[model samples]
Target: MTLGALMLVEYLRKDMVAHGKIGLTMALYSTWNRGSSYPRDKVIGLLGIIEPRNSFKPEYSWTVEKVYRVAMRAAIAEDGNLNCLGLISEKKQSRNKNLASWVPDFELHSEPFRDYITSLSKVLNKWSIYKAFMIPGGSPDITTDEDDSVLILKGFCLDSVSVVGTQAPGPDFESVGETDPELWRSSTRDALNQWRSLLPPNDIYLTGETQAMAFWRTVLVDLNQGRLASKKGGRPKRLDKSDLQDLLQLETTDGMEGLLSTWESCLRPIYRQLRLIEQFNRRFFRTESGYMGLGPPDIQPGDAICLLLGGSVAYALRKSAHETWTYVGECYVHGIMDGEAAVKAVEDKSDFTEYRLV
Candidate 1:
């Protein structure tokens, strides 16, 4: 069976019992492939499934942009968090310029990280490991503009993108029935090399991690083949000393050819993880303050990385006009993923700023 079909069946047996809120239902539905020809069906098609209906109604006359905006507003109101923003992707944003930057286009496919972002189990827990926001019981302090196209959020800009690396190779680089690994190896090697060159040689990040260590960790977004390994009867584990030892060889080797010749077997797992991250269509970047991260494919050197109130992860935003920011997409920055930035802000008495996302 297709993966989407299996996910549907699993949702029917498991998720359906737990998910009754509009936000959760919308997040779940975003993972599925809707076959409707009408654009409004993206939201209208799932009205029957969202239980205890608050204000969502079938309005065929509404524009697709309005439908998406209303659905996003209701989802955020019901959930009381900005988790829905995780579903926004550059691919989806590029499809419809009229849609609000804060509102996600449910019609397009998003990244796998959406599952972790929109998870309800992680909502109430403030002290969870690896969470970006540290404020306890924090909820989104949000408002809308006159036309509701602009979403005003309370948060502080953490850092600005100073350097961005090449876009990772897509799945087609290793096409079906292609046995040769040279093309894939060369492309991946070049990308990693470019990312490595962007950092200062022999310098340590603000988090006190070596540049080499942070580079590998950021490339994989600090995850061990979690979701991919679960299907193969293996539990996901965090990156450990042994994993780092194997990955650090990228620095010692002369090039991809030299690396492959000696430690190919030892680095197999690391390579697999890299391929998976590449499939997500991400780019490796660095902030002005020496923070390394994996951001959306469209992330640029001038983009602002912010931590919005009640957000589980960091976001990449671009300045559009005077004091207005456009949502780039979700991001994974090292060091600050577990609330380090938020804690420091409190200690330093840095006031949170209001961001108007359009």
Candidate 2:
């Protein structure tokens, strides 16, 4: 194996020995021009060791002992490839018009039918285990009778549970303005005025284009210095430029207001890009046919969505009021009930959710 691959194995082995900690979690990996070289960043991330190699500068090869350290930790009892758990990659070449390849270790298995069945069974058992503990989906009888396992095996039915969630706000078009003359005056006066007010006094002599550049330059400088940003807990934080692009490149709001407001004080720099708005649909909003469009695609009935709530908040603003809505249930289904039908069905019939496949 190449140094990169060896490093990956080392890190994965470490994660295995740690019972699923300290390993790269990426489902897909791409090497330059489809190479065998280890990804430098991934190795560092997995091993917590900085493999100092500059893309612009060549470096020495890794030592055998370094690679062995990873291998050693992964050995369950000194003779195995890994001790606690082994991660396998199941990559395959693809001919689809959209994607060229599929990655993710779980997908790499040859017996796809069996693999998916096993995967689904494990997931159901996991929920069943938790349900036995009186958790949200837990039932009292999941661990009860021998016959319960047989009933649950008939086919899992997901239950529909409604949790209160805050509705996301609509697009802030009044702040940004409309696209057409009938709706918008098409005047640059207000935006220009606001831009002028934010300018440093010395920029007065600058032409409009130059002044705009200067204003953005100042914001960029602040961004570089970590000034025009927000921080939470102990880590450094910055606005996600991708989320902003998705908002601009696509016309619809994807409930990303919290992510958008990090650099809200510096909004003009982002809004000035006409191409971003034009490209939003294609980049941010993907159609059902997989075609790109403007703005974030709306959540439709039967669409699979995850529900994630924030752990804490400092504001009552709708966006900050609760955690982001995770896309959990299948998007094509209208209600959570449809997505969880299998679990509910199993519970209804069996009075239990968890069971060992054995």
Q: Which candidate is the best by TM-score?
A: 1
Residue 319 displacement (Å), model 1? 1.1
lDDT of 1 by residue, 250-279 (tens): 566563455443323222322332222322
Model 2 C-alpha lDDT per residue in residues 186-271, reported as the tens digit of each score: 12222223323533344331223344343332222112222312222112222245532433221223322322333232223223
Query: What global local distance difference test value does model 2 have?
Result: 0.23
The list of candidate 2 runs beyond 4 A from truth reads 1-332, 337-343, 351-358
lDDT score at residue 202, model 1, on the 0-100 scale: 57
Candidate 1 TM-score over all chains jointly: 0.79
Name the lDDT value of residue 211 in candidate 2: 40
